[model samples]
Target chain A: MARMSTPPRGRPGRPVDPEIDSRVLSAALEVYSEVGWAGFTMNAVARRGGVGKAALYRRWPTRQDLFAAAINSLRTSGPVEITGSLYRDLTQTANRLINRFLGPHGMASIRALVDAKIYPDELGEALDYVRQSTIIGGRKIVLAAVDSGELPPDVSPSLIMDALAGTLVHRILLIPDTRRAQLAANPEPLVAQVVDLVLRGVGWQGTVSTRRTESGSGEPRTASEG
Target chain B: MARMSTPPRGRPGRPVDPEIDSRVLSAALEVYSEVGWAGFTMNAVARRGGVGKAALYRRWPTRQDLFAAAINSLRTSGPVEITGSLYRDLTQTANRLINRFLGPHGMASIRALVDAKIYPDELGEALDYVRQSTIIGGRKIVLAAVDSGELPPDVSPSLIMDALAGTLVHRILLIPDTRRAQLAANPEPLVAQVVDLVLRGVGWQGTVSTRRTESGSGEPRTASEG
Candidate 1:
C-alpha cells in the first residue's frame, strides 16, 4: 500500500516557471469563480489552464497544493504597502478587501473555501492561507494604526477590524442591492464613523472639541482639533 | 407537462403540522452543522428527522422550502425587550446578538448560511433571513437606547447597530477562539468596551467623569486625559 501510494510526483525547482503556475492559478480562479469551491477541481483547473493533467499534477500534487498556490498568488496581487497615514492606509486596505471580494476570482475562491471549512483537513491549509493572507491582513492594518498613535491605544484592534469588515461583509452577504463599488466609494466615511464611535465609547482621554458651523441645524460638530 | 406535475393532495384549510416541520428543521440544522450546506439535502434531513421522505415532501415540497421554513423559525426565536436604562439595554442587545451567533443554533445556522451564500437564490434566502433578522433586532435596541438617552439623541441607530453586530460577527468568523462561553462569562466587560468605543467614535457630547481602567500597565494615561 505504501509503495503504490508512494508520494504523488510533481515538478520541483527553485525559481519555478511563473508562467505555468500563474496560468494554472488564474485558471483555477476562473473555474472557482464560475462554479464556486464545491464545483472546483484540479481537473477543471487543468482544463481551464489549457495544460495537460500530468503537467498540472506535477506542479501541485494535491488539491490543497493548488489552492495554496492560488492564495499565495492572490496575496502577491495587491500586497498592501503602508504609506504611514492611518486614514489613507485603512482606506486603501478597505478598498482592496472590498475589491477582492467583489471580483470574480476572490468571490469564487472565498465561496469554495468557506464551503470546505466544515470538513476539517479536507481543505484546512488552504482555508488557513486564505484567512490569514487576506482577512488577517485587515487586522494587521488596524494593529499598525494602534501601534502608531492614530488610534487610541486602549481599543482592541481585532474587534475594530472585525466590526468594520463585518459590517461590509454583512452588507454584501445580506443586502442584495449593495454592490462592491458602493462599498469602495465611501469606505472612509464608515471607517471614520466607527473609529470615532469606538474611541468615544472606550472613554479615550483625548478631548474632541467640536468646530461646527452655526448653521443651527444642531449637527454634532466635527473635531475642532484632534 | 402540466399533468406530469404532481398536484397538492392535501385538503384546503388543513393546518400545517408544526411538530413535523420543527423536527425537520432541527434535523437539517444537525446535518448541516456536521456535513456543511453543500452536502446537506432533503433526503439527509428526512433521514435525520426520522420521518418518511414523503412526509417531508408533503410539507416543504423542495429543499428551498425546507431551508426557508427552518430560517423563519430562527427569526421568531426571541425578542430583546427594552429595559429603562441605556447601558442595560445596549448591553442586553449586544449580549443577545453575541449569544445568537455564538450559541449552538445561531452559530451552526450562520456557518451553514455563510457556506450557502456562495450559491444563488435558495441558500441566499436562508442567509438573508439570518442577516436581516439580526439587523432588525439590533436596530430596535439602538433606537431604544437613543430614546432613553443612553446614547446621544442624534446618534444614527442603523450605523450603530451595524457596527455593533458587525464587530461581533467578525470575531466569530475570523477569530474562532472567541467562544459563546467567554461572552457569557462576562459580557459586561466586552459591552462596556464596545459601548465606550462606539460612543466616543460617534462624537457624542458627554462628560467623561469616570476613569476607565486600562487592561494592562502600559503608560496608562492617554494624551488628552491629563
Candidate 2:
C-alpha cells in the first residue's frame, strides 16, 4: 500500500510527539515478533499502537524504515563497554548478545531479517547495518587486544570476529529448541569456551598459558576450563 | 486441506512409478524455492508436477511429508570422506558445503527450514535431519583427528565443529552479496583460513607448526595464514 506522496516539511507540519513515536516503535516490534517480515505491515503497527495510519506513515515512509527503527530500539538497551581484559570483555559482550538473541523480540527481528534476504536491496542494507554495528563493534575489542599485545600482531580481527559471532549465531539458528533453551539458561560456559578458542587461535601468550599452569593437575582440562 | 483418512496399504495398491515419484519431488523443490514455506502447498506442487491431486496426496499424505522427501532428495549428492590431515579434511568438507549452500536448491531449502522454526513439529523434524547429517558429518572428521592424536586429547569436537561450520555459514548468510561472491570465487583461501583457525584453537601441534616452518619467514603466522 502506498502512503501520501507529500513529504512532511519541518515548518509546515505539526511537531511529532516523542511519546507517540516510542509507542509506535514498541508496537512495531511486538507485531514483528508475532508475524515476522512476511506478515509485517504498517497498518497492523498503527492499529496496535493506537495511532492513525497517516501518523505511522509520516514517521516511517516504508516498512523497512519501521523495521530498522524497531531493531534499533531493541539494540539500544545494552551498551558494550570495554573492561580492559579481552577475555572478560568478550565473554560479557557475548553473554549480552546471546541473551538479546534468545529473547522473543530479538528472535523475531532475526527471523524477519533472514526471511528478508529474498528482497536484496532493502533487507540487505538493514542486515549490513546490524552486522557493522554489532559484529564489527565486537571486533573493536579484539583490535584493542592486538594493539596492547595481548594477542599476536599478526592476528586478524575480522576472522576472530567471524569465529566468535558466527559460532553463537549458528548454534542459535541451527540447533534444536531444547539445546537452545539450555543455552539460554546458562551461556557463561559456552561464552568462556568461545573466548578461550579465540585467544588460543590468535596465539595469545598471556592469560591462557597462566591459566593452563593453574589447572596443571594434568587430567586434560575441558575447552572451557581456562 | 485433508487428504484421504485411510492410510494406503502396501499389498492392495497399484505399483508406484519411480519416475513419477522423482518428478514430483523435483517439482516440489522448484515450487518451494519460488514461494517459500509460507506459500507452499500440495495443490501447487501437484499442478507444477502435472500430477493429479489424488495421486500426490496418496503418495505423500501431507505437505510436511513431501517437504521432507524433497529435502532428502537434495541431500543425496555427495558423501564426505576423511583424508587424514585435519586441515585438508576440514577444508574439503567446508568447500563442498559452501558450494552446495550457494547453489539455488540449497539456498531455497535453507530458507524454508529457517522459516519453518515457527511450525516447531513437522517442519522442525525435517530441519533436524538436515542439521544432523551435514553438521554432525563435519564433526566426525574432527573426531577422527582427535583419535589419531593430530589434535590434543582434550579438544572438544562439538566446540570445534561449531567454530568451523559457524564461521562459514555466518559469512554466507550474514555477509553481503559482494563478499559472498568473493568467497564463492575462491573458497580455498577462506577455507584454509578457517581450518587453520580451528586447528590452532584445538591446539593441534603437528602440520600447523611444520607449515609455519616451511614458510621460512621470521614473523609469526596469524590464524588466517596458510
Candidate 3:
C-alpha cells in the first residue's frame, strides 16, 4: 500500500522507481536534522540513503531543491478533521499543532527553516509553504464556521488564524522551558483562552456556555466579559 | 543635564565616566548592525568607538555581556506614551514597533538575538528582555483600559499582549516583502482590525463607535457584529 502511494521520479518521460525517491527524501530530512544547513551535503544524504550521489543530483540538482522536497514529505501528516463546534474544532487543532511544534522532529524542521532564512530567495518560498500549510490550513475551519453561520459574517479568518498561530509560536519561543512543560502537560486551558480571545475579537455571538463546556473546568474571569 | 542621567559603573568605585560608557555602547550597536553576530568582535567595537580594547574588556568581559548592554541601550528610545484612547495608544505603539522591526538597526539586532539562541542560556535571558520591553510594555495600555472600566474585567492582559505581539511578529516573519510593504505604507487599517478583534474578544461595552471614530475611514463590515 505504501509503495503504491509513492510518486515516480527522474525525467518526466523516463520510468524511475518511487521507492528510491522516497528513501532519498527521508534521508535528506535526517541529514538536515543532524548537521543542519551548515553541514548538510549531497554526499552525506546519498551515503545515508545508500544511493548514488548521481541519482540525487539527477533528481534534485540543488540543495534547495532537495530541502524543499524533504519539507514536502514532512507534510504527510493528516490535516485536522472539522468537528461541528468552532470552539471544539479550534482547541483540538491547537493542541495538535502545539504538540507537533514541540516534538523533536518538528523543532528540528523549524530550526532548519529558520536557518534557511539567511538565504533570501530560499527562505521566501520555504516560508510561503509553511504559512500556507499551517496558517491557511487553520483558517479553513474558521471559514467553514463563518459559512455555517456559527460565527459572525465580519469574522476575518486571516486575522483569527494569525492571532491563534502567532500566540502559539510566541509562547513556544519566549516562555521558559519549565512553563512550556507545564502548558504542554495540560494545553487545554491555554488553548481555550486563545480561542476565547480570538472569538471575542471577531465578535462571535455564541453562548458562553459552549466555551465553559468545552474547557472542562471553569476559572474565574480575569478581565471584563467579552 | 544629560550627565545627571548617567549611572555609576566599575567595581573599583572609580566612577567610570558615563560619556565613555555611552560611546562604547553606541559603537557596539554600529558594529553589530554592520557585521551581525558571526563577525561581531570586541576589537571591532573598540576600534569603532576609538577606545582601547582593554577599556572594552574592562567593562564587559564577554561578548554576550556587551551585546546585552547594547540591547539595553536600544531601549532608551522611550516607551509609548498613553494617549487616553486604547485604539490610538495601541495603533501608535504598533506602528512604532513595526517600523523598528522593519528598520535596518532593528533587523540587525533581532538577527543577532536569533543567532544568540544557539547558546541556550544567553538567548533565554536576551529573549526575556525583549519580551518584557516590547510585549509586556505594550500591554500596559490594555491594563489601564481595564482599570478605567473601558473594557471587561474578565479580559486577560497576558493573552491580549501575547496575541497582539505574536500576530505582529508572525506577519513580519511570514508575509512576503510586497505585502509587508503595503501594510507598512498604511498600517492603520491593519492596526484598527487587530484592535477591534482584541476589543470585541475582551467584551468591551463601548459603542463600536469608538473603533469607527478611531479607524478614521470605516469600511463596510464583512463579519457579524459583536
User: Best-fitting candidate, measured by DockQ?
Assistant: 2
Off by over 4 Å in 1: A1-20, A30-40, A47-52, A77-79, A106-117, A130-148, A178-226, B1-19, B33-39, B105-117, B123-131, B148-154, B176-192, B204-226
Write model 1 residue lDDT over B1-226, tens digit each, in one string: 2321212222233338878767878887767655455566888999999999988777777776666666555555366675544455556777777776655565455554455545654466555555556566666655554443445556666576666666666555554332535665766776666655555555544334321222233422221100
- Looking at model 3, residue B53 earns an lDDT score of 91
Tens-place lDDT per residue, model 3, B177-213, is 5576777777677667776776667777665334322
Sorted into a CAPRI-style docking class, model 2 comes out as acceptable
lDDT by residue (B19-73, candidate 2, tens digit) is 9988998899877765566667999999999999999988887888788778777
Give the alpha-carbon lDDT of every model: 0.57, 0.68, 0.64
Better of 1 and 2 by lDDT: 2
Determine which window of 10 residues in candidate 3 chain B has minimal summed lDDT.
Answer: B3-12
> Model 1 - which docking category?
acceptable
Instruction: Tell me chain A's TM-score in each of the predictions.
Output: 0.67, 0.74, 0.67
Report the C-alpha lDDT of model 2 over A1-226, residue by residue, as the tens digit.
Answer: 0111111222224538989988988899887765666667999999999999998888787888788777766666444665556776667667766777777665565555455556676566665666666665676777767765687877777787788877776667676777778778888878888888877777776663332223345563322211
DockQ of each: 0.29, 0.34, 0.28
